[model samples]
Target chain A: MALLGILLFLMIIGAVIAVETRNLLSSIVCLGAIGFLLSIVFLFLGAPDLAITQLVVEILCLVILIRATIHRRVETVAGNREFVGLAVTVVMLAIVLMLAISMMAGFPSLGTSVLDRMAQAPSHFYLLQGKAQTGVTNIVTAILLDFRAYDTLGEATVLFCAVMGALAVLRRSARRRPEEGDAGDEGEGGAE
Target chain B: MSGGTHQGGMSLIVRTVTRWLKAFILLFGIYVVLYGHVSPGGGFAGGVVIACAYILLTLAEGRERTARLLSERLAAVLAVAGLLFFLGVGLAGMVGGRAFLDNFLVGDSGAEPALASGGIIELCEIAIGIIVSMSLFLAFAVLSRFRVSLGDGDETATGEGGAS
Candidate 1:
């Protein structure tokens, strides 16, 4: 519990730094830190799979953000008008914190009742019958690959489509010839 | 100028570490994808790991080297092949009078957890892993290339008459 509290405190600090930092790289690094902390929190909550996915996704996000920000200049913040934005941010943060605290305070008892009802739910059915029905030891894998195969297929298709779209968009410049010699040389240099 | 100058990627230390660690990361990813049915990781997670390995390689080495290793064309082909393989596995279940993606290989369920235990699940995992890894690598490659083109355009706009 103390460890979790420390993690939450660090997460809050990271979130604040990510939002308030003027340097894009620092903001991205703070975001990655928050993601790492969140993954640890997930592991503490007994979701090792989620933690692994979260960590990898966080790394990928950091890579993508860094690539995007590589050639861009550092962001500059306006001083006087930024005060209004800060005030608004503080107000929003206070409201969210109050709501989150209330939710956390109310969650455990509410979760117990929900879990009690869910004990007799389909989760129990999967826990008991998943192995026999799917011939897989891991219930999650059985559910994803056997019981819920169609959903997974749909997700795969969506991923494929998204990739296709990205490829199409990015390959446009490659398809078009460079209009000038200087641009062509620069393109070759960049490609190398 | 000195030939020792590394113009593209990071310093020597990072490049050396990345070179040594790349193979291990790729091996771990394959292990995760293969053992997904019995382990915590699945196809998507393993695929992401594999893609990250390549992305790291691209970051450490130059783009030309990475592209020569796994070109965009190869990545595209692999992505398509993975999707076909996944669909083929699903369609194959229809042959044995089962539903799509049905686990037809009802072998001895009481046997030890081996490679061939999960019927079509393992096959699907491999297929998904290939699709995801290749597609992600392709996306990264293309996006970086596009950013280069954008940068080139900026340079051209700035140096239009001056270069002439």
Candidate 2:
């Protein structure tokens, strides 16, 4: 609880820094710090997986923001237009915080005992006897790999596609290089 | 214009500190990916670390080398590998009869939460991390490159480009 309080304090500080900073890069860095601290709070709350996911996503967001900032002056504010964006962002953040706090208040504590119960469930039994299973000691590992492997596979595929898609959108098509492809084709291709 | 071929006349301290920072970023990335299960880290965290490290490297050492090292083909390969690893694990479960990815027939449930049991998740996490890191790096490289290209003839553009 003390940690949460500290984290929340830090979160507010981060928010203020991110908002008040004229340097876009500094703001983005502060935003990333906010996310990192929030994920630590989540870890303290017994949600390591969530923390990991949040950390990963936050990094991705930071990279994207940094990329966007590279095209313009980091400290150049777009007059009052940015204020509108800041307003929208604050409003959205507030709504989300409200929803989250309400949800947290309503939830009951199940604790680590759920893991033991889940370990003994019928699905758990089915997971243990598998032949191709990797002899990992973590049941979460087995469930993730041997039992829920399909989901993991799907998730990996999705990430791969997302990465590819981002690369495609952000970079020149590798195949379009004249040196790599037919050099003669470019002159004709330009007419099309 | 401090564009006199000397790297903005940055002091030795700044240069050395930046280099150390890049190394630290890369090391942290490796740690996050490798020790994901035991700690509050995982493939995703590691991958992002790798991406940051790459970006820092690019910032310190020019883009061409970084681009060459992180080629499009390598990114594609990492993505495919992640997908294949995930599918291969699930297919093993399907072969044993309790639907796709079922581990009971494969003797997984009887397993303890030792390194071996956690290895699979770790593997998947690593795969995911690679895909993510490469993609983000690619995005950063492209965006910066585009802006540099656009700033070619305009003073204001160059000012804005260098300002960030």
Candidate 3:
């Protein structure tokens, strides 16, 4: 419990630092720290698959963010110029915190879950007959790839959109001919 | 390789280490993908790991070299192919059975916890893995090559040239 609390506290601090830090690199690193800490929390919660996914995704995010930011000039630290936006953020955070705290009352006891409390819980079905139905030992994978395949498909589609968005936004002369490139280079040289 | 605006990669130590480690990382990623049904990691995690292997290589060898290794065109093609294949699998299910993205081809092959088991699950995982890795690599390629221009107001930011 103590360890979990410490981890949660650290994650909150990391979040604050990530948003407040002037240096883009420091903010990125702090965001990465929060992700890693969250992954650890997932591990503690007995979700090893989620932990592994979180860890790898964090690494990938850090790499890409660092790569994109490394060459860019960030002379100015941009802040939220609009006070209304800041106020909205605070209000949203407070609402979310309040909702979370209030929802805790509805949560089951630490050692018990829907599987134990309810007879018709989906988890019970997964735990009992998942292997028999999907023929896979890892029930998580069985659920993801077998039972909830459409969800996986949706996730893939989302990833596809993200990649296409990046490509669309960042594409610059994807099919420039060699001659055109040389001509552009020569033009630049002439201007210089 | 010829026309990009990137310097040579990091130092010799980083390059050499990357050279040795990338292969192992790639293999580990495959292992994770292949054994995903039997293990903690599934296609999504494994594919990211695979992309990371390539990303590491890219980090060490610079964008041009990495582009040569994977290439922007090839990554895009692979991503499309992966999605098509996944859809193909779904259509295959429809031809012989009911429901979209159904596990029609699974079962009747192998038991639990083995490589042979989880029929369509394995296939779907491979497809997802391919899609994820290639798309991620494509995103990285695009992002790395992106140039943010601050000046030259008349040049128009969209068409401002950066050699692809």
Candidate 4:
């Protein structure tokens, strides 16, 4: 619990640094740090798989963000608009914190459940029958690839759509630039 | 912009490290995907790891080199092939008088966790891994190429015209 609190505090600091930094690269680096910390927290919370996923996803996001920010100017948003945004964010944060604290008061402690026996039966059934039904030792994998295979298929389809959409948008932009006749000169051949 | 022309990526040390680690990363990804039935990682995680290896290569060795290794057209084809393989596996199961994605193989469960244990699940994992890795690599490749094309605006026009 203390470790969790420490992680949460560091996360908040990292988030603030990410938001407030004028350097886009530093902001992305800070964001990656937060993601790494959050993945560690996930591991502590007994979700190693989630931790692994979070780490890899965070790395990929960082790579993409860095790529996008390259060749772009890093401009800081300042003045009255920034102050107003900060004020609104603080207010929202306070409200969220209050609500979360209140909700936590009603929840049971670790290793204890607010849910009744009947409500917990499905998980118990899975723990007992997962291996026999799926011939897989890892219950999580069995559940994901066997019991909930359809959901995974749906997720794959969504991924496919997203990739296709990105390609289509890129292709359209490439096509449009030619007709505009405002083509800039070719620059470097390698990474910038 | 001209700086990129001179030094494509980082100095010698970083590039050397990346080159050495790239193979291990790719191998680990395949291991994760193949052992999904008995391990912590599944197709998605493994695929992302695999994609990261290519991304690392691009970041280190430069886009031109990576493009030569796995071109956009090949990536697109691989993505489609992965999806088709997945669909084919499901259809195969259905054709065997079972439900879609059913485990059709009638072998006894192995004593130890082996590749042949899970009938259709292992195959599905492989398919998913291929789809995810290829799609992600394709997305990154397309985005990077788009950025380059935008940078070299006139070149895109001529290239597109020639291709068409």
Candidate 5:
């Protein structure tokens, strides 16, 4: 718990620095740091699957974001208005944290043992029979690919559509006129 | 602007390190996907790992080489192929008179914790891994290919090779 608290604190600091930085690259780096910390938190929560996904996703996002800002000039605020924004954000975060703490009072206390909690949940059931039913030792994979495959399918569809749409938007030829296809400068070698 | 006239990649140190590391990273990604049933990483995580390997290549090597290595059309085709493969598995279950995505190879599945244990689940994971890795690589390829109109008659690249 203490470790989690420290990690969360560090994540918060990283996030603040990311938002407040003048350099776009620095902000992206800080964002990556926060993402790594979140993956560590996920690992601590006994979800290595999620941790792996988060870590890789963070790296890809960092690469893409860095590429985005590489050609563009960093947007430098002229004055100390960013400080005011940071102050408001800190105040808002404090209130949300206070509310969250107050709400936690009514629920199960922190650091409760897993056995002491809801044992009759679907997770427990999955843990018990996942291997026998799906023949996979990793219950998470079994559940994702077997019991909840439709969800995975939906996610795949969403990803496919999103990427295609992004490609459409980023296409330089798409912005050009329809007559430009005959020009042939916008073909396969465009990646260069 | 740097590495002018070369258009190769980052510094010599990065390229050297990546040359030695890329193969290991690709191997690790394959291991993660294949052994997902017995390990913490499944299709999604493993696919991202594989895509990261390519992304690493794109970072160390230039966009031109990476694009030539894995063309945009091939990546798109792989993405569609993966989706179809997953759907094919689901339909195969239906042909066996079971519901979609039903594990039909339970009888022939190996030991409980072995790599061959998962009947259709392992195949599904592989399919998903292909979809994710291909699509992500496609996205990066296209993004890196993007060129901004500078209006100065000097329209260089916007990403990967040599960012100004």
Candidate 6:
């Protein structure tokens, strides 16, 4: 309960700071902090893997956002458009929070014991028969790699595609011709 | 010195520290990749660490040097290797007369919990980790190089044309 209270306090403070800050970079960093803190709370709630995945994805998103924003003009004051954006963001956040609260109120916890029992049942029989061969201690890994390996394969393929797509977009404006590069080099040499 | 205005100048001590930190990051990344199953460290974590290290190295040593160190060929090869390793692990199970990625058919699943206990699932984790980290590092390296080049061009246009 205390942990939840702390998280709530930090989140509120973070939200306020993110909205109130005039410096664009500071606001972005604050948003990243809020994300990191939220993920830490997730970890404390027995969701370490989700916490790690969220933390990584959030940090990457933050970096990409900051990098893009760095190249753009930062308005010191919140304009009308900015106001609208903030309002929309707040509305979305509120709706999501309400949904989460309501859903969690009715949600039954899927304890590890059930998963353990599953691992020890058909899976156990397979093991005893020398037919179950997955060696991951973490049941999540076992499920991910063995029982639902097809889904994991699909997700991995998607991630690989995304990486390739990003690389393609980025490589478009890369150094293309040696001549152009050489021209730039010669120009630099002449200037020096 | 293909020095760009945007690339901030650092003192000797700062450069030294950055270089040392870069080495530590590289070593840490390798550790995470290799011991992913046994520890909290895994492929995604290791890959991000390596990406951070490459970014740091780029900041310290400049774009051209960073590019040379992380050649496109090396990144591509690593990415391919990671993918192939993961696929190979899965394929091994199919060869054992079971469905695709059926590790139990290969005598790797449902073992004891000792160091030599667990079976093929452990290998799959390690493979997944490798693929994830390698792809991430490759993506970051390629993307950042593109950014640095554009940044270099902007610097040159703004009258900072001298090479360092």
Cα lDDT tens digits, model 4, A14-131, are 9999998877779889999999999999988887778888998899988877775665564454556677889999999999999999999977776464345356667777777777
Residue A112 lDDT in candidate 1: 52
> Which ranges of candidate 6 are over 4 A from the true structure?
A50-65, A75-101, A109-133, A176-192, B1-11, B104-118, B145-164
Evaluated at residue A181, the lDDT of candidate 4 is: 41
Q: Which pairs of residues collide in candidate 3?
A: none
Instruction: Name the runs in model 3 displaced over 4 angstroms.
Output: A71-92, A173-192, B1-7, B108-112, B147-164
What does candidate 1's lDDT look like per residue over A29-108, in tens digits?
99999999999998897767778889887898788777766545653645576778899999999999999998888565
lDDT of 4 by residue, B1-164 (tens): 22343236545676799989999999999998899878778888899999999888877767667777876678778878888888787778788577987667622454577887777788888988988888898787666656533233332322121000
Q: Pairing residues by index, what is the TM-score of model 1?
A: 0.81
At residue B110, candidate 5 shows an lDDT of 42
- Give a tens-digit lDDT track for model 5, residues A70-155: 64564443765688889999999999999998998888765664546888878887888887787787888888888888889889
Which digits, one per residue and each the tens of the lDDT, describe model 5 over residues B46-135? 888888888888777776777777767788889899999988988888875789877776623346487678878888889988999988
Q: In terms of DockQ, which candidate is stronger, 3 or 4?
A: 3
TM-score list, all predictions: 0.81, 0.63, 0.84, 0.82, 0.83, 0.70
What lDDT would each prediction earn against the true structure?
0.76, 0.61, 0.79, 0.75, 0.78, 0.60
> What local lDDT score does residue A163 receive in model 5, on the 0 to 100 scale?
81
Model 2 C-alpha lDDT versus the unseen true structure: 0.61
Q: lDDT tens string, model 3, A65-180?
A: 77656534456636668989889999999999999999998899765768778999888998888888888888899999889988998899899889988798656443343345
Which residue window of length 10 is worst by lDDT in model 1 chain A?
A183-192
Best by DockQ: 5
Candidate with top lDDT is 3
DockQ of 4: 0.34
Candidate 6 achieves a global lDDT of 0.60
Return the candidate ranking by DockQ, descending. 5, 3, 4, 1, 6, 2
